[model samples]
Target chain A: MTNIITICRKELKSYFSSPIAYLLMAMFAFLFGFFFWNAVGYFVSMSFQAQMSGRTIPMDVNEMIIRPLLMNVSVIGLFLIPLIAMRLFAEEKRSGTIELLLTSPIHDMEIIVGKWLAATILYACLLGISALNILFLFAYGQPDWKPLLIGYLGLILQAGGLLAIGAFISTTTKNQIIAGAVTFGACLMLWVLEWVAGYETATWATVLSYMSVVRHFEPFSKGVIDTRDLVYFASVIFLGLFLTARSLESLRWRS
Target chain B: MIKVEGLTKRYDRTVAVNNISFEVEKGQIVGFLGPNGAGKTTTMRILTCFLPPSEGTASVAGFDVLQSPMDVKRHIGYLPENPPVYPEMEVEEYLTFVGRLKGIPKADLALRVREASEKCAVAEVSKKLISKLSKGYRQRVGLAQAIIHNPDVLILDEPTAGLDPKQIHETRDLIRSLAGAHTIILSTHILPEVEQTCDHVVIISKGRMVAKDSVQNLTSRLRGQEAVAVEVTGGDNAAIQQRLEQVAGVSRVVARDTRDGRHSYEVESLPGCNVRGDVARAVVESGWNLHELRAVALSLEDVFLELTGAGQAAEGEKQ
Candidate 1:
């Protein structure tokens, strides 16, 4: 456990010491802020038009602003997660430091988990930026915080799944550009798999849609904590990290 | 102590390290000498648990590398050819991180880092970023990381590569100083380095163990096939060559023209034969003034070339 923490600490320090962390945070915050402003602006204009027309339609701020904003944050993560995870193993391989890590007393699983944890934490910090923007809705308006928390939970789980996949992709190459491009391609495929369900009703299409991460995240976006969605995200994370461990093991044979 | 028995490593179809075996006793600085692409790095990687052997077994500090690699790793420190280092980290921070990775207790991490830096002569660059330091300093920092935990065995792959002569000397001296307390196995193609620092040498050629013995023993083993060099005045080149070849135990002779009407002949003798006395008496009987006659001993360079060159020739013939 201490060995894992030591690896985690070094990985985290390396992430922050380079410009990758700051660049990722800046890009994520900027994009999420744009979506947040647009979502809140549309909500305010709709509420004003309702009040001016003498209609008392209930406008739940959680549905109007928070849910859409959380969904938008998830979309932004598709691009940001790849950037965060691309350098995890690629940089180590490029710099010849993988030899040191592999030859050390630490287990391969520990190194994989340590790096994945660091990338997940950085992704969480990106999600926190959008959460800060949503906090303003609760400060002045009468928005229930439960659904908003649930929405962010979904976003975290979803990001964890994607970052794990990105970590696995990072181990396949020594070039960060190739790692990033391949990770983006894989994430995009997972996100768009649900479109196949609309065109076909076959069993294969149903399985494809079930694998779509966006489809599983819908319930959480609407303030529901379904066990199936949680299981889906957990399984993806587990599978991604497991494949990463296998990839690292293959490196010993190929190195 | 380290022991390897019939270890082999193959990458895809090419055999990187063939079935070879050697051992290093406690407190011995053994030199792994080989030419390029001779599997020096591959063997070291297997011993360090960076790569598993395709055949046979290797045990480090009494732990099998394949069965209990963690136990083997705990007792060994390895420095690869490229000096595995992170360019973005400061020297002190990098050493501290490696110390932690090597399972050094947190309480003694700082002191261990400092001691390692001092020993490797990298304390002056402790605060500097590794990318900002010179190549020599970076190598010293690599050495520092390897010895930070002070393991029982140290494996260094071409540690003195890409350094100036002065830095090479200093690195060899540093390795020499660690000889008594630490069992060090350093690989290099430089002959003088092995002659200066290592107590024993294990020379590999074409991924096979060609020679393993002390430097003196290896050279002395080839002493039987030694040649004699003689310079004489007032003798025809052809006549001198013929007369020298007639000496007992002398197999062949070649004559060369020297300055001031002198002739130099190199006399090749049979195995275990001392023909220097015979050549001198032959010169005196011929009434030629013998200027010089001495037995020529084989140097380490000659032995290395003879071993690796033979391997290369055999490989060339196969192709």
Candidate 2:
């Protein structure tokens, strides 16, 4: 456990020190902030101007404020997580530093988890930086903190699933470019599975949608912590990590 | 202590290492000799537990490599042909990381890193990033990392593969300093390095172990004839040569003219025949002054060529 934490600390330090990590953070924040304003502007145009009002439209600041913030974080995270996780194993393998790690007393599982935890913490910190927007929303109106908390939880769950997939892709090759591309491709395919469900037949669509990470994220983003959704994300993370461990174990024999 | 029995590794259809068996007792510096692609690296990798052998078994310090890989890893320090190093890391940081990975106690990690840095002569570059260091310094750092754990066996594949003459001498001296305490198996293509450093030489060719024995015995066996070169005066060259050839146990003789018109005869006797007395008597009876006569022994280079079938005629002529 100490070894894991030590490796994790060093990895996190590396992420902070490299310009790539900082550049990704800046881009994510800018895009997320821009989308949040657009979402709020749309809600305002819908509520005012005496458009069509038969039902009581709850276009409160909470919907205009919290939902957009959560939605922005999730969407921006789709691009940001893979960039940080791309070098987890790919760089090490390319430089032959994997031999050092593999020959260590620590198990392969520890190395995968250490690098994943590093990326996860960096993602959380970037998300935390956007909390200033949430604080401003709190000053204007009574927004339920539950949705914000659930929104953050949803982002964590989604990012955990993406990170697992990213970790596995990093193990498939020593080229960071290929690792990044494959990870983005995997994440994008999974994200589009919900949309694909609309065209496919009912049973096939349901099964695909169940596997879709964004579908499982919906319950968490709506201020409801469904145990089923949490389990789904956890399972995805575990399965990816397990595959990564197996791949690492078998690389010597295959090579 | 190291023991290998029928160990082999094949990559697809190519046999990188055939069934080769050898042993190293505690405190012996053995040289792994072979040309490129001769399975020296493959055999070392198997001994270090970096790769699984396709067949047979090897044990280091009584730990079976196949059955107890972790134990084998803990007991061996392996330096591959190319030093596997992280260029971005500072020397001390990299050594500390390796020390920790090798399961050195935390309390002693700093001390071990310091000792290793000093021993490998990388103490001055301990704080410098490895990328900034020269190749020789980087190789030294590699050696430091390999020895940081103080494993029972050290398997170095071409430790002096690329270096200047001075650096090679320095590296050889360092390896010699670690002789008694570390059971080292170093591989090299340089023949003289084996004669100079190793007590025993294991020559591999085409993925098979061709010869394994002490350097002295190998040379003696290859020295098939008891050769004696004699420079004599006051003799007809043909008569002296013929008389020497007719001597008992003398298989052949060749005569040559020295610069001062003195005749030199090279006498080749049958194996195990000490005909130095007969050759001297024959030369004297032919009314020639026996200026010099001694048994000429074979050099290690001769043995290497004969055993590996390289430049054999050239070695014979040099005699």
Q: Write the per-residue lDDT of candidate 2 for residues B1-319, one digit (tens) a residue.
A: 9999999898889999999999999989999898788999888878876678999899999999889888888888878777778776789988987887788999999999999999899999899988899889888998998899998888888998888888888888988888888999999999888888899999998889989998778777856667888888887777777788889998888765565868787788898788999888887877779999977766776666676776666647866
The parts of candidate 2 lying over 4 Å away from their true place are A40-57, A139-142, B223-302, B310-319
- Worst window of 10 by summed lDDT in candidate 2 chain B: B310-319
Q: Indicate the residue-level lDDT of A6 in model 2.
A: 66
lDDT values, one for every candidate: 0.90, 0.83
Residue lDDT tens for model 2, A32-75: 77876786677667766435665566666656667656765776
Query: Relative to the unseen true structure, what is the Cα RMSD of model 2?
Result: 5.7
lDDT at A248, model 1: 94
Residue B25 CA displacement from its true place in model 1, Å: 0.7
In candidate 1, which residue pairs get closer than 3 Å at backbone N, Cα or C atoms, i.e. clash? none
lDDT of each residue in A187-241, candidate 1, tens digit only: 9999999999999999999999999999989899899999999999999999999
User: Which numbered prediction scores highest in TM-score against the true structure?
Assistant: 1
- Give stretches of model 1 more than 4 Å off: B224-297, B310-319
TM-scores of all candidate predictions against the true structure:
0.90, 0.83
Model 2 in CAPRI terms: which quality? acceptable
